[model samples]
Target: MSGLPDRTDVLVIGGGVIGTSAACRLAEAGVGTVLLESGALGSGTSGTTAGVVRTYFPGNPLISSLAVRSLAAYQEFAERTGTDLGLERIGLLVLFTDEQQVQDFRDTRAAQQAAGVDVELVTAAEAARINPLVDERTVLAAAWAPEAYACDPPAIVRGYAAAARQAGAVLRTETPVTGIDPDGLVHTPAGSIRADTVVCAAGPWAGTVAAMAGVHLPVTTYPVEMLLADAAGSAPRDALPMTMHPSSLRIRSWGDRILVGMGRPGPDETRDAWLQRVSHHLGTTFPALAGQGLEHGWSGNLDVSPDGMAFIGRDPSRPFVYAAGFSGQGICQAPAAGEIVHDLVLGKESWIDTAGLSTARCPGVPAGTA
Candidate 1:
């Protein structure tokens, strides 16, 4: 990672899944691309993602489309990049206890089905059959997507980085971007890089990176916690699917271990209190797993937008494009985000409608801001 390039066609800041994927797409299109990462690839939020891949966004069409497209790319990842992402096509089961939630899901199911997503509303019995971990008595209905998957997040970052390298993108790990000028000069610890276009995909730190260029991105960072516990005694007979309850507790089987994720803890909550809350929900939802000892716990940040959507468009005043504010859906939506970045950088029309994902859509930002 020596001899910092003085100039390139594109400079991508961040080495997470989104940045690497954008670099891969740009380089594949014959653009001279340079990617800079402050730390090791995927060492950020991408490394700690729950890696649940599903196309059920309820009312968001943009996210649903991006997720579906990303899922397809992930399925063909090995064929295109010759890299294994550890993709497991274990279905997704979303359990709901409220009648209104069930009706909302039923309404959204039609649109999802029309969009080619294999999703359906099922009864409690049907949901239990798909994932026996759920307490059928407490569930009113569930949404089932047979094409959902759980993947290895770090492997995905590595796979995309390798593809970008092979496609002629210069990738430098540990090369932190220090400053950026509106005229396309990117300052780094090694040296400065000048490029015709730049992209900021720094995950949770994207707002900080964008501010370096004098642009304001309304991205908020929040922490998400997850735990892994041994489910040897109560493990389902068949491999369990990624299961979720309305309480924002997500559980999925990883061999003999169960990966459990809880919603963001309150600002006043301590780590121990958050873990206790997660454990309480886990035990209450599945009585069989009561008193299970957790093997590991970790936390990562999510860059969220006010509307809970991503910003994927060119900056109106800066000489750069940005892809951020994934709102915890980065892993499942990264491939599409990369493609959108490539299209915006090249001044080409994206295959999907990206009007709603622009930074201008954010509240308080002027219209046409991005």
Candidate 2:
């Protein structure tokens, strides 16, 4: 049995990037905030992310807007806090193999350009010129978004946590939140923290934490596995854009080595099994990666909300809040998300309309989704 005690102004669950970020924003805005993680900071989806920053998406239009806004926010955050969290603007390279896909790429490119995205359509040869590793035969055409980038996710969360603490927010790692009492107490393995507002940013396990508060979020878990390639010894001369292969594989160069992500798997697979499936899939997809050897690999579970957008607002029926279910698209949106969540908690007006992210956006979700 662990000791649990009394209450704070706000308690946050799943101390990953989103939670840490909410804490940082709230604290900086003079709101009392405390964050509790089951393990270490950034130990979940935020830690092992490919850190691929992209402004190109076929479906979600909010993605393009958020990507651009978040990119600017990341740069400004780094300069403001002096947090060089390894954020890099390496651009994005989306290759096509067939005529149909090329047309599709063009359609997407046109959509991006219309949305004020700085992008270019390049020939396969031009793509090869940008990155010599890209073969002309395999790549028929490519969509290039020069504004896309990458970052070291775990380090970014750490930086946010540090800044949050310095601003008077309480961050407790290795301190798993057990539940959220209806009466405003955050029960944890270490103790109980009292708060008027509770935020759940548990990523894949977000539903689990919401259930602790008698909330049923229609979110399923899907994990993606990523492999780290052996360093090429010298720094990569060609700025490797985030490359998305037609086969659902994403290869990203991280300075010395490359991050080969098998991409997000479906919801049927268990949290642990997704990695194995992705690893096997990645090895089969990339013949070039066969003998070079895998330096390291990891899996991060993602929570897919019913609507595929995040739940980032206060509880309509209960006294709590949340920012979950980015569907693996959280990093690029974190900057604006943090600001929105802080304002929502304080009932302050926010420019970013969070109507689509309310817990009420989907019925039966946590009252906090309101």
Candidate 3:
């Protein structure tokens, strides 16, 4: 925290989607930028994401609104950059078994509609018609957002990292930040880098990284677990629409495989175990999935901000900026976060409000946890 061996206009911690987007935007703006990642690119939650980019979040107005913007940014950028990110506008089908939960979904869909998201509520009969596989008894109602989408997270992640690098941001792989200083000191295993501004986008490890800077962040990072099936011979032609279950579970198909995940899976189970549990649970819930076999299972830790949104903004007392604790939806919201950080760095007006997500709004430093 003492030495200033290297210098840059901005220093970004964490090379995940959020950090990569920030670096790309910052560098494109001509802000000398340096990005650091503890591991390989897109190896975190971003990698594990089924690439679902939907606007049917429970009732999160801020998140849903920003998701709309982020999704647009992704689509536009992918086209302009000529990156085959495998983005698909497959829509989303959020299922509800409980009547109250169904009502909640209806209300939330209405809210999303009001927020400019093309979301609609459908009856159980209509839902069954949409996806005959959906157990009619288990569904009370459903919401469909046709504009929602999914993509290959690896492509998106690599696209952004590559763009950031091509745009002039110096990127370091497997570069872990050992320490940070409010005034702009970043220590890594390889060397040190100094900057006038430091942005902490350390995904699930945001708390620990913030700690090195004498700051505490309120983020409970947990493992992102999912079950991936190769479809063996019954591979569905990606008709799944990033469906969600009453248990906050989500299922989608990637290539010839299917990936089942959770929007909120207790925050305790590892991906390895969650896959087994979810696969078994799916077997019980839907008899059709009785013999469904899981092929490859993977897990990654995703930082969850207490408020279920990303922690983005400048530290009130310290001269540092941060963007992490995205719960488990960072991949979809990465662009919005980057735009905000880019504007903040450039002294431009914010395109959206991010007050509630301020690291100062909540407390509980990501206390030295693994």
Report the C-alpha lDDT of model 3 over 321-354, residue by residue, as the tens digit. 8888887788778998999999877668797766
For model 2 the local lDDT of residue 237 reads: 63
Q: Candidate 1's residue-wise lDDT over 294-354, tens digit each? A: 6566788888888888888887766678898888889988998999999999889998777
Backbone clash pairs in model 3 (N, Cα, C under 3 Å; residues 3+ apart or in different chains), count: 2
Scored against the true structure, residue 141 in model 3 reaches a CA lDDT of 83
User: Cα miss at 325, model 1 (Å)?
Assistant: 1.1
Model 2 regions lying over 4 Å from their true place: 1-6, 99-116, 230-239, 264-291, 294-296, 306-308, 359-370
> Which candidate ranks first by TM-score, i.e. highest?
1
Worst 10 residues of 3 by lDDT: 361-370
- lDDT by residue (1-370, candidate 2, tens digit) is 3443355687878788788888898999888787888998888878667786666665456667666777777788889989987867788887777899877666666566665578777899988776655666677888787877778787779888999999998777888777777787777668777888878788888878877876666668886667787644443566677877777777877666778776654668664475565555444434344445554577768888777777777667786676788888888778777878888888889866778767666665445531
Candidate 1: worst-modelled 10 consecutive residues by lDDT: 361-370
- Every candidate's lDDT: 0.84, 0.74, 0.76
Compute the lDDT of residue 173 as modeled in candidate 3.
Answer: 82
Q: Which candidate is the best by lDDT?
A: 1
- Candidate 1, residue 361: the lDDT equals 76
Could you give me the TM-score of model 3 versus the true structure? 0.89
